[model samples]
Every structure is written in structure tokens, then in C-alpha cells.
Target: MQPPADLLLPDLDRTGAVPMLRQVYLALRAAILAGALPPGARLPSTRALGRQLGLARNTVVAAYDQLLAEGFVTGRVGAGTQVSRDLPEGLDAAAPPPPPAAPPAPAPDAAHRFRPDAAAHQPSALPFNTGRTSWDDRSQAVWRGLTLRRLARPDPALFGYGDPQGARPLREAIATHLRAARAVRCDPDQVVVTAGAQQAIDLVLRVLLEPGDAVWVEDPCYPALRAALAAARVRIVPVAVDGQGMDVAAGIAAAPAARLAYVTPSSQYPMGVVLSMARRLDLLAWARRAGAFLLEDDYDSEFRYAGRPLAALQGIDDAGRVIYVGTFSKVLFPGLRLGYAVLPPSLLEAVRAARLLVDWHPAGLAEGVVTDFLAEGHFAQHVRRMRLRYRAARDALVAALAEHAPALAAEPPDQGLKLLARLPAGMDDVALAAAAARRGVVARPVSPMFLAAPPVAALMLGFSGHEPAALRRAAWALGAVL
Candidate 1:
């Protein structure tokens, strides 16, 4: 017979000062690690655990939620929660072990076809990754407080599945915020909340493109966008971008029966060029002519450091071909995994159905907290503060690069958090990046952002997270590496 589930928890020592919930969590986790609670073992229900430990049911539930978030355990409908079947190797063992023996070698030309994108494999050590925020202690405290408050509410809906479209409060809040900040005209019914910008991209691809359909993407665009299109098995035609952004005439001329076109018009990634108004008009005309959907990834448009903020493509899209993708990752934090898409009326139902089938919806509590954050104006205030801070950092980076590495040419942009520094003709970006890593400065090569061939040798450095002083130091360190 199996041991009682309540007996799985370890006895607590009287002298420990740790919080009861934390102690219970650690003790239960320790049992799993020690194989005292083996794989497939069903954990006691929250009520039973609370009774066993003389704690509140809510405390046990919170512990379980943490475990679930961390992939330690899983809860199922009707069935009790159980330990994850694929625990880390040797984690269930009692003793520390040695390395395993090498496996047999593969035959030559073994048809091993899986190859990940180069950008995905690259080591990321930068304080501000693409679409990430500078999360300080205060933000963490706010998140914790919100989580605890949500936990206190007695709602079965919190534990069960949520509306695939997303929580109504968040969708409504996003609609209000976008209208005021981005000049986007939309209602709560038009907003479709997603896991992140990536998920929004995927949903758009699924709803708009069928297998073998053609799509046009910016030549040196975000690599993940390229990866997503490739995964969908759609043929992607690369449209070259100039200083003013993607060349509209060239894109129109090269259109190969494309069902959609993806562009970052506000501030192009890696290159950091805002699409000119004339070109934006020309591109929209082409979309109208070809009956193509345009995906506008407004990833980092919030922190425009130069001149007046440009109106979004969606705001100006009269032909109803633009699908606007926005995310809170840049403005608030990345790990929250909150993003939204404003779809054209024609594609709304199809995209909503696709989202329903794919992961149902984002976490309910996260949506609720973010909704409250935006409604209370904390989100807007934070964005304004970060915009100013990022501008200062951008200015410092440009000045430092000019002072230290005079030979290198740094392309200055009117807006966006990241800038590209064009390296000398023969210098290898990979080698320089490796050297910079040794000096504790992180930067990415722009070559990996290209599709067909490397069009330029440059380094993409983000200034959003680092302050001006830190950027100056990092620039000096990078100058040494180069």
C-alpha cells in the first residue's frame, strides 16, 4: 500500500524562523528531490495538507501554484495533482553521481535535420534583451503583493481555465490604453490578448497564411519573426530596408503572391529606422492592391528618444489590412508574458478560434494584475519614466562610442532603445562579441538578423535597462574588446 499523502511532508523544526508556507513548500519539494515522493505520486489535496500541517488551505494552494509555475508538479481536471513524470535526471536519486558515458556516434550524412536559429543559440547576458524591461525590487514587491491578494479571493474561476480571448478587464484596459497612447481606434471586443508578441505573431500566421502561402518580411528583421514564418512552412520573401525603413516600391515589385507582409514600421529592429510617411502610404497602397495583411510589430515604439512620436501603421491603415501587435514586455516586464493584437474585422473570428486552440489563454491572475496596473495609471507613469531614462542612456552610448572608437560608425536613430554600430570592414562580429563577453559587456551581431546573406557587419546594443553611467562604462569596455 502507498504511504498516506499527508505523511509525505517532512516534520518542521520548532526553532526555524521561516514562514510556514515557505517551510512547507521547501519541505515538500525536498521529499520529491529525495525520492520520498516519487514520480506519478499524487499530492494531498490542499484541504488535507492544510489539516495535516495546521495551516490554511490557501497557504497550501499558494505553495502548489508556485510548484506548478516552476514545472515541479501538475494539476489535472477531476484528478489530484501529481509529480511531473520527467523530473531532471538523478533528481530522484539519494546520492550525487558521476557523468554518463558517451553515446554511439552517428553515421555520416545521417539526415539529422533539426537546426535551430543562430540567434536562439547565442548567449544572452545583456541587462536589456529585446522586448525585456528593467525589473527592480519595487516591481517585484508589487507583483508579490498582487499575487497574495488574488490568492485570498475565493473564486473557482482563478484555478480553472479562463476565456481564450482573455480576462475582460485586461482586454478593456488594453483597448483604453492603446487608444490614448498609440492613437489606435479599437474597442475591447477587438482586442485579443496573447502570451507575448511571439504568440500574437504565431496566431496571425496561423489565421492568415496556409501552407505554401507567400509572405514578405523585412530583410534584416527580428530573427524570431523569421523563425515563426519558417515553422509555418510559408515562403518568406525578404524586402530590403533603407535608412527611412523598408523600400515600399521594391516590396511591391517583389511581391510573389504573398498573403501577408510583416514590418516594424515605427522603429525597425537592429537598424532602428522609422518608416517614412511617404513609404508608409505607398506600402499601405500595395497592401490594398494585393489584398495582403500587414503585421505591424510595434515592439519598442514606446521609448522614442528623438522628435515627435510617429503614428502607428494601424492608426493610418484605411484599407483594413494591418494587424497591430503590442506587448507589455518592453514597458513593464518580459516575464509577465502579456501581449495583445488588434486584428482587422475580417480576420478576428479566425484568429480568436486559433488562440482558443493554442494554450487557451494567458494566466488569469497575471491579466488581472496588469489590468489593475494600467487602470491605475502605474503603467503609463512607468513608461514615461523609462522613456526619459532610455534616451539619456542612448545619448551616453553614442557619445562614448564616438569618443573611444572613433573609427567605428554608430548609426544614430530618432527613436528606439537599441542602436547598431557598424564595425570596420574586415572585423568579425562573432569574435568581437566573444571578446566583449569576457569583459562582462554583452552585445549582439546584426548579421544573424539577416535572412539570405549578411548585408552588413554591425553590433546591436540595447540601452533601455542600463543607466547613462553604466552605458558609458559598457561602451568603454566594448571599445577595448573591439
Candidate 2:
């Protein structure tokens, strides 16, 4: 009798670099991950699968045998091959519970401090959220490998409470990465590792600013910065940005008395503008004269698409005014939640104390893995590969928008992974974004990034996490919603 022909098989092209068995493994793994082939789904016989994929029966048998060894499949004489029913106990779907009821109100001071309105400050949706990276399996494999190696290490340091600042090796790795990739000059001792960039921001605010002290945050800047500063009781002064970058002259004029100025100069958040050399020098000079420090967030600067990447502000700060912040969230993965702050020699002790008072330090094992990953150059290689992939995705998004959404206009950015698309006059970006989300496309409104009042209506679309084809479909879907 003949075998059933409905079983799916992976089509492997000989021209690709991946091995055939690995491709087959990935195809089956992806099917499982997507729930396309549910647990206990029947698989085809090895002989039947061989014919479908144009491979020898032994090759098919070998692939299935490996799957069985990995506990991903099972077999019986009459039952044929089937996906494992056990599924490691957590693979099956489950329904989520409903939310709890509201509680009674509290006293006046308590109510004021614990107002429900605080929830409004939290981001409802993360459409086009900045600093997101592609979370593909290839990247996961690298991290997993690093984790396993770290687990095998016999050192007691791996299990102990890490230094409140960070692991020395990880700090050294960061110093090397920054100097090579960002042109920033700093010693390993100057790097203070934290949970992530947000934590670093909080630490900087706590250590540097007192209540009522003024700080300059870029107008239409990263909203979280405003919240962080507000939570620290620092008065925020908005400084506008132009094509060159943050308006340095305006920042000096508006907040000359401010103690610190936060700028995303490498690729300004929401706008994706690179700070030009002239403006960088001007801002550095202004900070020196105003006796203010510059908090330069160079997040996602590794993915520059245009000419040579710009040097970080810290590299050029002769006055010891730049507090440089960077994160592995974009370079590695966000879930790792590792970031570092490179402070001038003067601020090191204060920032270290704040970090110690907050969370003590980030995880030791994760930091060790990252240290190995960076030391071995895997992080650099991953960044290089993703940079090319992101450039392609960005171009695809641009072309698709131009073809499908003629009414929308995107300001081309010289660097960075995201860009702003201006809606035609009369269209409401906030409403349009709501409609887009319903269609499975996550696009954010540009208005909320602004301070006090919105200056324009636009959408911020991120291309780093998606492929070229997927980005095109997302853009088309967005157009249909509009």
C-alpha cells in the first residue's frame, strides 16, 4: 500500500549555505513554534518524505531519527512518525484569567500619591518602539551557546553576588566595544552596568539632579526621559531639534541654568536624525560654559546606513561633561536587559552609589555570557549581519509606502533603524494608529513624543524587527487602514 501524501516537507535549495538536515530541522521547528503542526500531529513515513523533498530515504530517516533523539517526535510500527505528545509540559495552549475588580479609594495624600492617573504615564501600546532588535533563532542560538558555556564554568564568581557596578570582564568588554564601534574613549573602570538604559537614566538622574534643578530634554524626545526626570523631581526644559540635530543654541538659551542636558545625538529618538559634527561641538561647548553635563544616549547607533558612523559625544568632551549611555538591547537582544553608562571620572562614585542603592547590580550569569560573546567577537558579527538585513528591510518599507501610501510622506534618515512618516493634512495620526493596530500592523503616533503640545501629526514605523517582505505587507496593511 502507498503512504499518505499530505505530510509537509521542507524544500531545500542547493544554492543556500545552510545544510539540508539543519534546514529540515528548522522547518519542523518553525512549524511547531507557529502551531501549524500541533502536538501529536502525524508525520509522513521516511520513505514517503524522501520522495517529497527529492532526497534519499536514508536522509529522511536520519532527520527523523535526530528529531526523535531530541524528543521532538515519536514513532510506532503502525502509527508512523508523530509530533511528541508530551511537549515538555508547557507547549499546549491555555486561556488567560480575567482581570481583578477595582479596590476602594484611599486617603487624600495617599490618593494623591497613588492616583490611578499614574497608569496613563505607562505606554499603552509599543507601536514602533525604539531600540527593538530582530529576535530570530540564529541570534537565540548564539545566546544559548554562550549560556551553556557559562553554565559549564566551575568558577565561584559565576554564582556569587556580582560587583555593585558590574563584572570587571564585562566592563572591559564594553570599553573595547565602545572604542572600536562608537569611537568613545573610556576606561573599563568608568563603565557602570545597570539593568538597561532606563535604569541607567534613572541612576544618572538620581545622582546628578536635586529637586527643582533644571535639566534640558530634547523637545519631542524619548517620553520615558521626561517621566524619569519628573519622577526624580527635576524640572524639564524642552529643547527643539532640527535637521542637523538638537538645537544647541536653543538648549543653551532656554535652560542655561539647567544642570544636565539629555540628547539622543547618534540617532535622535522618534526622528532618527544623526547629530552633525558642527552641532556636536557647539553642544559640547555650551555644556562647558553652562556648567552642565550632557547625557548622550547613543542607542542603536551601530546600524548606521550612510557614511562613516559619527564619534560619540563622550569622545569629544574635553570638559568632562558627557555622561555616555549605551545598551546591548539593540546589539544583542532586549530581553537580556543589559546596559552601561560611561561617566566622566568625576561622576563615577555618585553613579556607583546610586546603582548600589537601587538594584545592587544586574545578573551575573547573563553578564558573564555577554562578556564571552563580546570577547569572542560574536556580538560584532551579529551586529554586522543585522545591519545589512535592517537596511534592506528599511528600503523595502520605504518603497512599499511610496507605492501603496502616496498620501503619506517619510523623512529619510541618514542612520538608525526607525523613521517618521508624516500623514497628509486633515488625517489624525492617533485615530489612524488605532485603526492600523486592528489590522495587525504596529505603528505609533509621533505626537506623544513631544512635550506639552504636539507640533505635528505623523507615525513612527520601526523596521529592525521585521523582514523586508513583512515590512512591505505591514506598510500595505497600514495604507489600507488609512
Candidate 3:
């Protein structure tokens, strides 16, 4: 079929930012919608169109292909291409334009109140900030090599929207790794890959919680998790965490019908106390009796510097009550933004559906690279090397505290990344932290982490991000502030 002689072929731009094919496609699309090319108007064959427009056959074909895919045009076998008879509703000039997007509303007070960890806010900008990970030259080199390999031949399927649950290979890899490393019991089917532990916590709450539902949150816990729960309008029962971790009995007394409880069981945040084996059972028991779920945040449990890593609460759960959350942010790097939630079979469907509604899914490229990182043994290798390096840093920090500031008692964590140093009696930790920040060091106030009154006066100092020299220097400076 040949186009009419009087029909004007759209002009192509060779030097413009827009591709020649896209330009041709847009012009043809606009003409069809404007009724310049009416319904059932036969278009020239690909070769004829190319010759008429002085373009290669492929370019014209590509333009037509896009139009065909988008329903602006149609093609018939043994016939020719024509504009779609049943065009989209808005294509006609008589159709009303879509209403403009409403202006964004102002955020609530809580938006300003809930802050990320100090280390999350460009920790490298200052010295010895909490929650930062040490990235040595070897780790960076290995990461670069993995990234290049992953990019060398990216799967074409990744170009499209990925599975809401996560990439299958990544999930499978995580499941296998968790089973061996963290003693997490799960199949790939039960794993919901999330952006991070933060999102994993949010997703679980979205699935299980309703407005005003009772939720047991650890006192002096991770602020980001607290903010998320607060935003959901749940009644947060601040459960005390002692040497044994969350006081399960106090939580039962406070909120017996609580739908969920968030715990850093393996190593409690800031304090770094391992939840005792007895307490782990008590928590699991409470969840079973109350028909509640336990969200175990197994963050940084892999880097146990002393005895063996404490068993994760998720590992021992036979009642299918624990929703295990783990993140690569601390172990691998914060920017990776990769994490997983091992849900019980009962909650899998609801959680996966909820995840689809929020952000759809994480990027496939990052997941794939991490999948390869684990499968190729790089993850274990990195953890082994980092454990040794961080253990050294932790020891140096503790020793420096003993030498420089004997008043500030520092007990190194057997597991996890940071340590809690108790301040002098009546010394305001918030004021001390502010003072320390001004001196180019981060001593996160422990009182703010507490939800109940009469909070402990302490500072949380991280040693994982810095070398021994920097850790020692930061400790000496903190002593001067005290």
C-alpha cells in the first residue's frame, strides 16, 4: 500500500536530542489523534515510508511498531497498516483535558520529628558517627568488579517492572544464605524482598495492623521504626528492654491484645544486649497465645566479635509467629537498600499484596547484583573480612575509652556494630551529643531513643565506620567534651 501523494511525511531531525524514530512516532501519533489521518486511513509500507521520509526501513518500522504497541495504529496480515478505529478516549479533540495535579499538602509534625540514624545522614562528612560501615579498598574493588559483570549482560526482562515480592533469584539466594548464616527457617516462597528493614517493618504493620491497634515497641529502640508505627496511628506500648531484651511480661501487662511487637532480639539497638534464650521463648509464647506477630529485626547480628552469634528469634519459631527482617544496609552498605522479610505462610499473601501497593518493588539490577554477590561467595568473604576489621576497631575504641576517659564506662558489644557508653550521673546526653557534634564527632543521645520517662543517660558511639586511629581520636575528643 502506498500513502497518498498529498499526505505530508513528518520531518526527521538528525542532530536533535530526540531520536529520529521517536520524532517520527510522535508526529504520526499527533496527526492521527487530531483527525488529520482519520480512522481506517491506510499508511505506506515500512520500505515505502522509509523512502518517502529518507530514513532506513528499520527506523520507519520502529516508529510504526511503537504506534502499534501503544494502540495509536493497527496492522493486518496481507493488508496494510492503518490508524486504530477504536482510539483511546482522550485522543479526540472534544475530550476534556485531565485535571491538573493537586498541590502537595504540608507534612505533619511527626514528619520533622522522625529522623534517620545520625550515620544515615552522611556519616563520612564527620568522624565516628553511629551506624556507618567500614568500606575498605578491597571491598570497593570487589563491588566494582561485581557491578561491571552484572552490567555486562543485563537480562532484558529486567527492563520491565519486576515482581512486587522481589527478583526470584535474589529471594532464593537470600533464603539459602539466611538458612545457613542467620539460622532463619524459610523457603523462597516465604521471603518478601523489601527496600530495607525499615520498609519490611512498615509492610508488616500495613498488613497486620489497623488504626488504634496495640503494638509493643521496644523502649529506646530504633527511631525509624518508632516513627513508622506512629505514622500508622497504632497505639505504641513502650516495652522496657533490659539485659534480657524486651520485657515480654511488661508488654503482656501493657497491651495484652497487641497485634504486633518489634524487637531487635539478636542484638538490641544502642545497648547491644543479646536477648536471652529464655526471653526468646517467652516472646514466642506471648505471640502464640495472643495471636500476635513478632517482628524480629536481625540487624548486624552477623558481626559477632566475642562468642558465637546469638540465635535469631526467627530460627526457633515453630508457631509461625515471627516476621524476620534483615537488611544488607549494615553488612553490605547502606546505599544498597536491600533487605528481606521472612514471613509465615499465613501472612505471605497479605504482605506481598501490601508490598505491591507501596512502591511496587525494589530495583531488579540491585537485587540481581546482590544475588550474584551471595551466590558467588563474595558476601560471606566480605562479612568474614569485615568482622575481623570491625572487631579490631571495637577493641581499640573500648581500650581508648579506658585510657582517655575512665569515667565513661564503655563495654564492647559481643555482636553488632556499635557500643553504649554510660555518661556521668545527671549529665544530659543530648547536650553532650550536641557538644560532641560541634567537635566533629557523633555521640547519639540515648535518652531520645526511650519512649518512657526517666530515660538512661548514655551515648551511642559507632566504631565500624572508622579506623583504629580515628576511633581512638574520636574517643579522646568525647572525653574532653565530658
Evaluate all candidate structures by whole-model CA lDDT and list the values in order: 0.80, 0.80, 0.85
lDDT (C-alpha) at residue 475 in model 3: 81
Q: For candidate 3, list the clashing residue pairs, or say none.
A: none
Tens digits of lDDT, candidate 1, 305-409:
666577788998887889999998778877778899998889889888999998887798888888778887777777777777777777888999998777678
Candidate 2 local lDDT, 1-482, one digit each (tens): 22335656556878859777777777777676556667778877777777788877887787788888988888889888888877854554554687797786655652332222232242322434445677566767988898887788745975667788999999999999899888899999999999988889888888888989999888787867777776676688988877787888887777787899999988787777768999999988888888889999988788888877788988988889999998888777777899999999999999998898889878998888889889998887888788888888788888889988878998557688888899998888888988887887777788767884456799988877766777777778888987
lDDT of 1 at 81: 82
Q: Which candidate comes out best when scored by lDDT?
A: 3
Q: Candidate 3: TM-score?
A: 0.76
In model 2, pairs of residues that clash are none
Question: Candidate 1 overall Cα lDDT vs. reference?
Answer: 0.80
lDDT of 3: 0.85
Off by over 4 Å in 3: 1-124
